[model samples]
Target: MSSSLASLALVQQKTGAAQLDRFGDPTIVGVALAYFAVIVGVSVWAARRTRTASDFFVAGHGIGLVALTVASVSTSVSGFAFIGGPGLLYSVGLGALFLILPAAVTNVLGAWVLAKRMRLLGEVRGLMTVPDAIGARYRSPMAQGLSGIAILVGIVGYMATNCLAMGYVLDAIFGVGVTWGIWIGMGVTLAYSVAGGILAGIYNDVFQGTLMAVASSAVFVYVLKLGGGMAGLSNAITPTDAGFLGPFGKMTPLAALSLFFVFGMGSLGQPQAVHKYYMLRDPKQLKWYPMLKTVGQLVVLLLYFGVGVGVKALVSAQRMAPLAKPDAATPSFLLQFTPALLAGIVFAGVAAATMGATNSFINIGAAVVTHDLPTALGRPLRNELRWGRISTLVLALLAGLIAQYSGALVAFLGVFGWGLFASTTVPALAIGLNWAGATRAGAIASIVTGLATTLTLETLAYLKLYAFPAGVSGTAVGLVLSLLVFFAGSWLTRARAAAAIDGDVRLVMDV
Candidate 1:
């Protein structure tokens, strides 16, 4: 019996080794090269149009509704949806769905709360960055500067997450070591971002978003076949791990609900998606954004749900071994189960998500460094265009280092960044724009509170020094505290609201 067990172990080891050997197929390598060449072509085309700081930052406010919608979807989805998302689903079971469940309504909420006002404000007052909108709303450079600081922090964390994902996908596709994959991935993304700016990012997003939609939909069909549909998936997983299909899966109820709440409300504060509203040529098109974005997100998110359950079901049925790590779910499924060509497309889709998001963050980080921070400090640069490009390089380098050293999983890093942005920006930027009674003091207070609480709690948790009880997230705590402070501070400074908000800002909000 002992010898039989040894033989089984040997077989499993060989299976794992065989799976590793499948990484760099010629078909996949060819597809990846072809896709990248197309991306370079798009970047070159966009570079010609990106002559000014305004063009670099916001595509010169000339993007059409469809392009803007797709770009927004691509940025919002990112590597988290394609790679980290499935990993989370594999790790947490049903609980992972909480992270994206709010997509159904968040886009509509964003449209009603911020999109029209943001675009109108940009057109009226020439607003360029997310903090610029905050500064205009509250009439405070200090508020803008603090907001910029928080955005910069979140951007680095978020960029590192995407860069890490790019490392994984590139490694799987090219058979490069993860370290080389990271460096190569950053180089490719940085080249286009530095050359074409947001214009390149936007058009590339249009292409990438389309590819993701097609690949995700097609791959989901394969997932269904492998999992034998919902019934087979349940039969396989339930007998071995019944809890995985429960409402909250392995997570405590509180944790699942917290995820839902944070991700739901947090969408309002994500600059990568919200900032694109400024690029829409016509504010009248804002009415369609919610529906269009919701449909697009739902369609593209198929791979997020499909790959995870498919991998889990296969493992439960003893068809595949348990994954070495949750993040391996997507790549493993692609390589082991799908056709080589389909795997290549999905692999490219992963790169598309990571590179697109990295581009957005670098652009925002650049604007923060070159335009927002300097202006808030009353030292605005004369050549923001040149400085913005340089700042992108610097920010990319810093984030790449973080990606290299951080031991956290891609999904967790993405969550931290999301939480940071939600806590810091939601009350100050999203709420402040819609509420007439929000004072500059309140905005500053919320930003300070959010930034302080999130950074402190996340840092402590990361160091293993402390953790919240099950179901309680540090992000939720920070966001709740920030909201409380925002209201309290505004109440205390209620008389200053009229003085804080400009007449034009009031008109735009009212409209």
Candidate 2:
């Protein structure tokens, strides 16, 4: 069976290069247009439901568990799972295991530590954004404002990352210039996001997530069928490259594990992931959240592993040439193996979802700028929704432009955004929400410490001034420092005797 499978895979690889030549197939273009029409329809429906600020921010806190689960999982998948993940695996083999570890674990950990506490706070405080929860938790305008600033910084970087990815995707599929592709992505996303805000993100996520799940599954099946089977593929690669099958692949063990700390522990600080917590309609439904989230994440991630291994196997067997660039691995796979119709739908859907994800980042950043900052300063805007829409458009446009001119700046910001969020919010928001002794001073200090550490380290590394140790990522360092500062600051501030959490909040926490 293995011998036959290997032969079959070799035959497929020989033919795969010919498949890549179908650059602008009409079938693919047609599918993309049809899928886009569906997205526009969903955007209109969501826009109708999004007349109020609360509706724009949290879908009026009416999103059901199933929808929230799929959407949350979908949002987390982002560009990394579909586009970058396979490339990552191709370059470093089992180095992606560190990422996969957190991918599986964070959901359960988040459900236990964050889901209930955040959801409860949202219900009790009528929270609209993550910074709103931070403000209410710490009862400090300074902490709220500082967190808002941190969110804004992260948003620029996060949005830039998405824009760059979209640019590449559009360039490949439509043969357009990368800059034009980014502008196109920004225009489409801004239309619905400005119209519907989080409602657009939520409904679009559900729609996009369902499409991604189906397409990802079909692609995975194709990968397996083309490769014959995973075991056969493994055997083919094992002889020539033993390390490729090892647990750490080519990465230093320390570097591999650094991905874990950054992604696993740092995930709590991710405003985007935790953003969905506020929209769950029922608190008890959270009991099922981790399972649904994990299952959905794993299902979508099959493409990440399948294509990486399948392509590696084919290359080792001399049936395929080695990839020209790691980033091209995914596009190469789709062009070669998947049916033209399916490839069109999957690629277009993934690109649309990328825009939708960017919409979310812009929406949250706008909320922080317009609603949370003013509210913290005790001067709430009467026209918050209007200003927020304006901010979202501006932020998206700014990010798209920045992505085109300053790829390095985007990389610097994007690299630390996760850690910055994790370090700043994890202790102050995630842990603090559960720990009553968590003082406002501590939250404030931690946010400052995290922001400072991440910016300094990432910038220095980018400048080639004393690189981070091979296994040590800037994110892990920042996160550790932030936690330490939070504890030390809290201990000192506890001397003043902080106010107890509100009776209502306490009551909800106990529930």
Candidate 3:
């Protein structure tokens, strides 16, 4: 009898531990349901306000500064910062920090170089998309059409990354398989994006951003407590993984710097953030945008660094088993270690990040299909507001398919998307708006070069057909080539370039 009792007790203890390790706790499910409810409600509210193409695409240029800042950060960070970022850190140690630490300088650069100019151009021309701004700046429909094509390609990849992360979150919270999770997640995002457009996306971003900030701060504190703080975390990881806490972590110096440089300069061209300039209610509020965006991003990034390092410390300390996959790092840690309620909040935050980004991308891509492409072809859509929502549906489904089949880590896909945007847009749109010397020929040349080079290189790498040097990235090379072609093309055609600048565009640049 005594032996039997002991056996029963041991079995019960083991079962309890197994249950804890599994996802889909009742508390977590409950919180996630509530979060979804809030999202749906916000979407419905915004739908009522979305009356025209302007409202759908640019929120009628009435978004307050605070909302714009929060929404931009929410879109920019997305699942990359919350989910892929932690996973990258877990895989590469401190090198992953390179991906995020550039937010400070990048935010400032975006404001000084692009924010005011984009806003003024939007006002001057009633522009609605990044391609529109490019067309307006260069006075060339072909430039707009090519850039629109580039944006469409990048949108699919970037939206897939976010949708993939959402699938992971849904799988953890609902015990649905990733395939089903992805479809469900995409459905929810589509509901809001199709109905409310960017107006819904903006407010949704504010809500999601607030939740993510609170949850990340709380999780960081919990991580410190579990790992016995930074010094203890370092000691725990260093013995098993030598130099895991170095400045460059597991990556070479050149590789780490490449991440910093690419992400820093690349950020200037990210349509998710750059597009928001058109929605800001007051251009003067641009003075505060850099500071506000940087602070918000830093607070949220605590989770990015904390989860990766904290999980590593625990595994090294023999307190937890090693993770089966790096991308599982965030979800695994939350399920087993954090309180159920906190875990639920973080999961919801992950979904929020993904959904917020998807909404913005959907809106942008739809505008490209419905507005920019047609306008470039000299046949603007008569009912852009209606066709915009339909385009959103088609784009969302296509992106969902890519999210399922891409078979790449979330972080890598995110980087690929960022690179595509930077390569295609930076020289043409960002620089062209600032430099009257930039010609239509230069803008068209840069877009074509960037689009072709990035696609070929990234595709080959994905298929294992080619590889770059140990510390080099295809994106860095593509961006460099694009920049060179932009300047060289302009210089070679300086007379035409000078003649191409419109009086209104030149005035906007001066402002």
Candidate 2's C-alpha runs over 4 A off are 1-20, 408-415, 496-500
lDDT of 1 at 496: 68
In model 2, how many backbone clashes occur? 1
TM-score of 3: 0.96
Q: Tens digit of lDDT per residue, candidate 1, span 154-232? A: 9999999998889889988977866788789999999999999999999999999989999999989988887888888
- Tens-place lDDT per residue, model 3, 1-511, is 6985566555446534753556668899999999999999999999999999999999999999999988988898898888899988988899889888889999999999999999998998999999999998888899999999999999999999998899888988887977888899999999999999999999999999999999999999999998888998999999989777889988888888877877988998899999999999999989999999999999988999999999888777666666666887888788878889999999999899899999999999999999989989999989999999999999999989999998888898998999999999999988888887888888899999999999998888889889687766788888999999999999888887757788888888888
Q: Compute the lDDT of residue 316 as modeled in candidate 1.
A: 76
lDDT of 3 at 146: 94
In lDDT terms, how accurate is model 3? Answer: 0.90
Error of 2 at 64 (Å): 0.8
- The global C-alpha lDDT for each of the candidates, from Candidate 1 onward, is 0.90, 0.80, 0.90
RMSD in Å for model 3? 3.8
**Cα lDDT of model 2 by residue, 34-80, tens digit:** 87788799889988888888988888889899889888876777666
